[model samples]
Target: MLAAAALAIAGVAYSSWIFDFIVPTGQDRFRSFLSELEADDVPWHQVYSYGDIVAGVAAVGASLLLFGVRPAGRGATTAVVALGVFGTATVADALAPMGTVPIVHAATSAIAVFSLFVTMGAATWSAFREDNWPIMRTLGATTFALVAIATGWMLGSDRLQGDYLLGLAQRIQVGAMSVWLLVFSVGTWSSTRHARRPKRVPRRR
Candidate 1:
């Protein structure tokens, strides 16, 4: 489970950081895409195509680890669900252009956000319930859940982006949660090592 969690976190971080380059984009794709969306000139099909391809690859990896291996069933299930949501949203977005089907895109985005929360919550629960490591694991899980809920609510309310300080705080909250997960991973590994050690024989009086 620890290994799987580590892999999932690393994969997500890497994908989030490189998603723009992973998609087919030229110079200034970011600015251009944002501008197009603001100007109502964005190509929904192209956007969905790029998103689906990237998300599909991540989904495949997550599915294999979650279902095929079965080490971390709960965490894996969360990941699979998240991937499914993304996949569905991508297809919906592609079929229904934002201009022609604004509601569809809006709904898909909302579902996607909900799925992300579910994924993180599941991961935190998985770590928390592992009896081998309690304190750090539980603390990490609690902190993550609280922050996830708080930030999610703020973002959903559309207040975080409007307030620079709130946005910065949200980022800090997430970053702290990520660090906690990393710490929990290390604690898990240490516990595993201790569990695998041979019992010491009692000394003769």
Candidate 2:
């Protein structure tokens, strides 16, 4: 799922550059948001469209798998629900391209970001009761902090219309979220792998 997300983002970035839709090096960089690439006039817009669809599908499956396993605590359950919301919002973004449905696209994207924030917070809380969960908790906490700070900065400043900071904040939030999910996946995989060990057979009597 993380790989799909990374690739989709890469595809979008590449398409944006190729089409001159967002020249990151230019003065207009601050005004260049991700959604603009999804506009109808952009060249090769379908790449981002289809890539997000694939990523969203992958996210849905991954979230369900994570949720199905060991949902034994409130924090863990919250994480699961947040994960599902993240997937749903991702799919919603894919279905409603910015050009075709700008309002819906923006709304879903906002929800997705909120869901990701909750996911990390829940994971951090859930990790407190499990062995070897410190690393996961630390990761979750760090990611949450970066995103929260960046988002707050974006909201605190109106210069996003004229400065590059908003774009920087946006990338930081998105990138950190993806990295956090990768860490979560690895930690969960390790835990489940060790958790299912079978009992030793009784010695012959």
lDDT of 1 by residue, 119-184 (tens): 556555555663434434567566666667656654554543443344344444434544543554
What is candidate 2's lDDT per residue for 73-179, written digit by digit as tens? 88877877887787778778868977788899989988977887787788788888634345676775777688788778766543545554665566555556666
TM-score versus the correct structure, for each prediction: 0.48, 0.75
Write out the backbone clash pairs for model 1: none
lDDT of 1 at 113: 44
For every candidate, C-alpha RMSD to the true structure in Å: 7.1, 5.0
Native-structure RMSD, model 1: 7.1
